[model samples]
Target: MYVAVKGGEKAIDAAHAWLAEERRGPEDVAELSVDQIKGQLKLAVNRVMAEGSLYDPDLAALAIKQARGDLIEAIFLIRAYRTTLPRFGGSEPVDTEAMACDRRVSATFKDAPGGQVLGPTFDYTHRLLDFKLAADGEVPSAPERAEAPETKPHIMSFLDREDLIQPEPEGAETPPDLTREPLELPAARPLRLQSLTRGDEGFILGMAYSTQRGYARNHAFVAELRIGACAVEMGIPELGFAIELGEVELTECETVNQFQGSKTEPPQFTRGYGLVFGMCERKAISMALVDRALRWKELGEDNVGAPAQDEEFVLYHADNIQATGFLEHIKLPHYVDFQSELELIRKLRREAMGQVRQEAAE
Candidate 1:
């Protein structure tokens, strides 16, 4: 007996209301303020901004709270919101060389022109859980240094003196926007870097780890990792002058890789590069490795069929929002399709049985 299904709309509405209530928790409890979330959950905000292609901390925090800490969902929310925002003029590329750096370090060099500033990193911290943080504990402040100059010099300049690393070329051409346009193959450096920055962090990390595990390993050393804010300027076409739009925190990674010099070409170390929004060093580093791996073809290296080398695979599955959405959508009702398949199987079984009986009788 078949029963007609009803109340789907009402049921959905009720479920939504309950979900909202659960997200908020008890009415007596204090609601999560955007500032609190932004400050306390900075890492989550950073991930959302990186993936969502938006840098608003408050908006990312709100999305996180609304999504109940489902980071991918929060990223999706931010992406949807970001799409509706009207496009302003594109900014002149922020000169990383001129960045007001808060943190700068080089693994390749013991000491460089611009002294290494460790800044804020979890690198030195012990992994043991801090029981003090269980309570609302405040961290002791370290002695503060006097405010220094606004701009800090890059360490790469030392290597640049020897002509070891590739010099960044100045170009008048504008880079393609991956969001507005479809991602085409054979992308430029800027386009490829853009996609990698907003890619799934875990996937990028895994691919990077795979390289260390002997998949197209190039023996990479961190040339430099810098985190700082850079001014974004936009040119007013009518005025013919660029104005400061804003500033954004960026993590830039440059890796020195083993150079493969041909008989004709002179031996020199090559570089892998990554640049990403916010303070995402790990993502940036991983991106740089993958970027270098993908360039094997262009660099005249043999195709090793590495995961990182496969542009189609990396670019296609990098976005967690797209991947998770399509994957989780399978949970949605597919009863009609399932019923059709079931009916086909049953019909085939009956036909086969009939043919077998006829053959036996004969």
Candidate 2:
């Protein structure tokens, strides 16, 4: 049975009122709208959606506003709101191969089949701050572009024809849901991928960086990175076919690692994969590296006892919501435990003082 901490009604009400007042900020300034957040603060909305495991941009933006721009707290609000949502039938795997390319590039190929198309990126921009934005935030119109090719073939397919990269046969008709299932050790690739895609970005990025810093022997080559809109199809049993639900923006990364051949297999390059909602290239790349690091056993490699290689550790600590609850609980009322500790410490001190006085008197 859960114990409700009863009391402090007035104080709680006062705190809430003050919090609302603070959230509103100065009366002179205009309030931010959800549409503005969804349109301008696209990355922030993407991060909340990715971590919250909800793809709705408008809801994510509303959560951000409600949380006063605290992303983790925004994610918490989104998660709480998610519980009320009804489950629609799951969609078939989205066809990334036929994605309408917004930004597609490959490090493995200098002049690949579909040449690099640099769409809105910060990669080449000088880091200097534009002080003009302090007063006015106006920008000129972007250059128009002709529509890209109807189909941009995956770069990895070229290597696959030559048998250079390891093959990944599709298994598991339906992937398991981490939200529904209790996380068990020795998780399969599908489950691991599920957790990684929704996992905390900072944690995943740090873990991936650790591998790059010699914590693990997993170094990745960017075989291909693509960002685009793909149609989502949901199976309609009544209609006897799947129908397109809508389009969702996705970022996918495929990385090739060093070749390692076991006794049964010949020397071939291994691969890592990352796919997430929106143009989250950094998180996608991080997830791919970490994914590769965790696949040591399956790839017939010995474990070096790295944190990233430990599925149990990574999976348990990856969810920021779970981590925050565990951590934040300590700050709540722990009066009973704190009082017990205080009494014990005082008793020990009294005994020591008494012994010292007795010894001196004798």
Candidate 3:
């Protein structure tokens, strides 16, 4: 068995070399630099970073290059590389309320505070593709800043002031880290949020869409969606003070759901929240809806047997790395496993045939 496994070592090495060569593509074409991927293919980098649970755009870009533009594979590389990194102290909770707004919009209010800043959005644009991009080498003019960047307050506060929305009390000061600890059943909101944020975009989006299609629909409305940069700060235990680490682009979505009233308390609008890495507006919005759907039990709402409402189902399968590993393992050598199954099937067939003959004779 050992020799048989070792015999394929040369073939595996050769296959890897061939894959590397193929990843480079035609020699005539200029190679895609990691910087190019980081700058130009920023959205792809963001997806990789988000799903991989890593924040380094440069590393994500290099992974994309090495993976030959396969985003999932790039994310896989990023996730694998992340395990080798040393653990540093956690950063302080980001202040999304004071984010330097790049793109901010509110579906519930037209004339929201700080005004509707539609920064680099395709909301109004036609779906038709621009041939100019296909022609290539044409540099579009740089986008001009309408005014200086400034911090803006979240729109959820507006509803909160009137006592129309449910109040969000603080959770544990030190929340559980999903990466370090095994996921426990009936996960808290923080753990669920972590899984959703680091979850696959397509999977999250699909689950959110299911809710809209009447699978535990929460009647979620986008109270506000903001994409901007927020400063990260962490406390140094030695210094007994905090220092700014750096700024990270984030997209936050807060949704005001249907009114929740009971016999004891007056009706107030419930809310769902999503905060994701970079300008992933769609993912953020989807996350908020799913978050709301999953909160059915906590919100005094009936469990409608929806897939999104199943916490165990969502968290367990949301991880692409785990899903891919289990799924991809089928392709590997399973000779012994298959042979046993094959023999069992043959014996079952023979027994069935014998029984048929016996019955006929009777």
Which number leads on TM-score? Answer: 3
Q: On residues 135-209, what C-alpha lDDT tens digit does candidate 2 reach at each position?
A: 898999999867645567999999999999999968888788888889888899999999999999999999999
Q: Summarize candidate 1's per-residue lDDT along 1-362 as a digit string, tens digits.
A: 23455658988999999999999999998999989989998888988999998988889999999999999999999999998999876887789987778789989887666678898889999999999899876999977888656545566676778987656656446888899899998777677778888999999989888888889887789888999898888998888898988889889998888876654335666678888888888999998898888777656677788888888888888989889999999997777777888999999999999999999999
Instruction: For model 2, state the Cα shift of residue 69 in Å.
Output: 0.5
Best by lDDT: 2
Taking all chains together, the TM-score of candidate 2 against the true structure is 0.95
lDDT of 3: 0.90
lDDT of 3 by residue, 243-310 (tens): 99899999999999995675444688988989899889899999999999998777778888999999
Q: How many Å off is the CA of 55 in candidate 2?
A: 0.5
* lDDT (CA) per prediction: 0.85, 0.90, 0.90
Better of 2 and 3 by lDDT: 2
Stretches of model 2 off by over 4 angstroms after superposition: 1-5, 147-150, 351-362
